[model samples]
Target: MKMEDYTVEFCPWCCEEVVIHAVGITACPSCGKPLAPCSVCWDAHGGCREPCPYGCAGAEADEQKPVTTPPITQEEIDFVMANY
Candidate 1:
């Protein structure tokens, strides 16, 4: 799906509102935090859960990965500077 098809979700790390695609990882526009949709699970109680019960793809692998911010490229810096 295209970027526009994804819902705007909050960054679990920074609590900033941002748009991240349902598949793959994307950086938060506000805090530059990277996340994949499967990184956190939304429970029926409307609370976040780690390791989704529904077995979302990459959920187990994501749990094994360390939380680290990817290096920002010049293009990203320029885009942010130009826009904000």
Candidate 2:
């Protein structure tokens, strides 16, 4: 089912299933923080992805992984400056 079709939800913080009908409420109706989404891991999938920084608090237990990013070196910066 699509994420939009989900009306009832389980709060990650409080671990309680909540029936959400309003669009304005973002937090868990039970513990307020149960449904908090990780800003760094949210994607177009309508839910948190793997290696969630928030540890997937209320979703499931999984081994945490490291976040990797491309390294920027001074040589690369200099080359860009020379061209642009």
Candidate 3:
């Protein structure tokens, strides 16, 4: 494949660098972990040419603020501990 047809990424599972092709499910040669695009890479490529096998199509939206619950009050924690 042409140089532009692939990307090099570090595989965290295998702790090694791997070559991921843009056209297919590129798995890590060492640990068999599928190399999928992250938000950074997805944005860099302006989106993949095909549907990603790992279903990371919405990864680009991760830049948005994460949904989080409000902090629990000390009274709430005390009530739970007392009941338990």
Best by TM-score: 3
TM, every model: 0.40, 0.30, 0.44
Count backbone clashes in candidate 3. Answer: 0
- Tell me the deviation in Å of residue 74 in model 3: 58
- List candidate 1 stretches off by more than 4 Å: 1-4, 38-84
RMSD vs true structure, all candidates:
7.4, 16.9, 18.6
* TM-score of candidate 3 versus the correct structure, residues matched by position: 0.44
Ranking by TM-score: 3, 1, 2
Give the Cα lDDT of each candidate.
0.50, 0.41, 0.48
In terms of TM-score, which candidate is stronger, 1 or 3? 3
Residue-wise lDDT of candidate 3 within 26-66, one digit each (tens)?
55555655555442346455765455445544444422322
Q: CA shift at 46, candidate 1, in angstroms?
A: 6.0
Model 1, residue 66: displacement in angstroms? 8.6
Please give, for residues 1-84, the per-residue lDDT of candidate 1 as tens digits.
233334356565687655544445556656665565543346677765655543434344443343344443445445444453
